[model samples]
Target chain A: MTTSNLHAEIARAIQAAPLLSPIANQLLQVTARADHEMKEVIDLVKCDSLLTARLLRVVNSSAMGLVHQISSVDHAVSYLGERLVVGIAIAECTNEFLGKPLDGYEGESGQLWRHELFTAIASRAVARHARAPLPADLAFTAGLLHDIGKAILSEFLRGTSRELVADIVRGDTADYLTGEQERVGLDHAEVGFELARHWKLPEALAQVIRHHHHPETAEAELRPLIYAVHLGDILAMMGGQGTGSDSMKYHLRQEYAEHFTMSKDDLALLLLECSEEFRKVEASLASLKET
Target chain B: MSQMVLGIGDLGASNHPDAEIKTYALGSCIAVVLLDPQTRTVGMVHIALPESKINLVKAKEKPGYFADTGLPLLLQEMARHGCQPKGKGLIIKLAGGAAIMDHNDTFNIGKRNLLAIKKILWSYGLGPRSEDVGGTFSRTVSVSVRTGEVILSSPGRPNWKI
Candidate 1:
């Protein structure tokens, strides 16, 4: 396929792809609100049976180590509190979409999901450490969805472009993003950005998906959000949680420290903290496993 | 065949002919493979940092997390497995230690890790026979006890024996 045709085809696929279910989207929006009450969140969750089931299963999972079983969404919310419950809900809601492997990226079954979960977990910690101005929920959302395009574009790769991607994944080349752009006419970041737009996600979130690999190109106001997810992706990879094929080709912006007003010492500490956070997230993800 | 995976802060050595040891996603970390060509025993360590001076407690607990501590411990295990000394049928191969594109040179842990491994190995009068180190790529290193051969793989590259 020609460059434009391939881009167009990928765009069509993103539109048809599984999206954040409406209830999940509402739950995320509600969780993002500072004024949201525990009762309000509980009521919102109770309306969706699937979400409620997922929440209870996770809260009661061995990872939580709760002595008591969570019988309902209300019990889960009260026991685990708001943010933890919301994080679980997000994972449950997007489980289907993010769960599949991106063969083009060399991810085996569930590899992409695990990789995104780590990124989401690390993104929140990174945002907190960097003191980003946006709501931490937004950081988590961006991080989780950052690589959604890989799934969409997996089917579109072909010919020499496919070879370049293979080479990039193998570490034969130092630039996967650039190599994709040069050979395939677009990269996953750009595809993810368009995907987010198609879903009508927040403008900032779309920009983040686009500029994550190149935070320097994002608008000044969105840099922190972009940087948080950017650094989170880097931290996840360096922590050895990379998905497949494209684990270590991207760059880590040095100016991120200056931009976020953090020192090198602070960055290192954040990584240590993120690694700890990653383990917790990994354990919690057990809830997503087949029962 | 028995295959063992070495995590980020792990080390293992094997003398069994059917054993194959491996480690993956070695970013900014170093993977050292030591082998006894004659005995066909193999030792591998995945070292995540250059030194243990900063986190002595962690280093003490997981000696495989740093080149300074892990390299020596890995060599000791090789000896326990009946590996010959320095140039007498002993082979060392190195892989991993890749800095990202935008990371400042000062914080290049990959470079630091390679240097630390070199320093420690030099202290013991040993150096790598072949290396696939540096660059902005994560690699997986594997060694087979039967053949005493080391293979290195990166994201999109073919597995090349070192």
Candidate 2:
């Protein structure tokens, strides 16, 4: 296929992002002034009691299902600390953002959130395997927010036609990117990347939006962690961990195994581990009511 | 004269010489397609992760866990099976990395994965004849043993014949 102009699309999205959502601005203010300092962030976080309640409820719910039962928000917070708290908060926030259907992703609604959550968990699992310094919670938080742009775009795609969805379901960054570039002069990925950057999400985290699709072209610093998220996404889709428009068809790179030194059995086992872990967490979190 | 199917980690490829070995829908994961004409041997790997830097025990348990640990074994598997790069002139083809992600997320494994694969291949002094790597869409790759012809297919388009 012809090469897609990621830069051009990114540029368009960057310019358009300011006109888009106030959420990016809101989150950035807290994260920046606070330097993402958890206490400060938590202070910002606390303002969203509904969000926190939702978060605590999910955490408590999921924990109850785990062999390690956690009953209270304070206990969960103390145990998981701020790192995981951010991930839970992100999950809580995005749940609303992705609540509507995404036209670009085949009218997928909340499917984005489900897909992202699975991917976030999977990213943490891979990070654990890689011995990356990122705690599973941190990796998960980054993974969870990796697709923030997509969430913003869902509103734009709210009432698009089935033909467009069909085209997207058919596939290609070109197909989906083209439509976005034509309409808003940028694709969601680029838009998402800019959103992440503006939010001052760690640059490493921002890279997820920039290169999640073309890991090969991602910034040099983010290759490994991005790869983990990538792998996590594949596993999540393959294992049916959540709903998504692109689940049934995909393959992995050979060097990933070579890069990580895992065999098929190893990959399979990792997948099993992810599933088991999610089940434990999900069982506990099932008590959470939607905000 | 022998048709060998190289199952490298999570990836598998068949060299029918008269047929093709194919893998589909690469998202964040990488698919390494290797073909040897003279040896009539072709193989592929559907690697799902980078390096096993996280849990070596788990990595050891699952061999398809890292490029460093898995690449050698793949070559060894090919060598042990007599599909060594002894002339049929090895051709490596790379594909996948369709993060296929939602509109707002980053989790960019596609771009990062292709980078890792490139580094490994460079270290090994090998690369694919062609590739359709990275995008928001999935891809399918098929290699014909007889002609060493590789075909890739994705949604909304026909198989990319090369």
- The CAPRI quality class of candidate 1 comes to acceptable
Query: How do all models score by TM-score?
Result: 0.87, 0.50
| Top-scoring candidate (DockQ) | 1
Clash count for candidate 1 is 6
Model 1: lDDT equals: 0.75
- Residue-level lDDT of model 1, residues B30-142, one tens digit each, is 88988777777888999877777767887898899888889878877877777754435668889988766667754466787798899988888888899988776678888
How well does candidate 1 score on lDDT at residue A280? Answer: 67
Model 2 stretches astray by more than 4 angstroms: A1-56, A66-74, A80-84, A131-135, A154-185, A241-244, A248-259, A280-286, B1-162
For residues A57-133, what per-residue lDDT tens digits would candidate 1 score against the true structure? 77777877778777967788787666566666656656766777666666667777767777877787778766546
Model 2 scores a C-alpha lDDT of 0.57
Model 1, residue A4: C-alpha shift (Å): 3.3
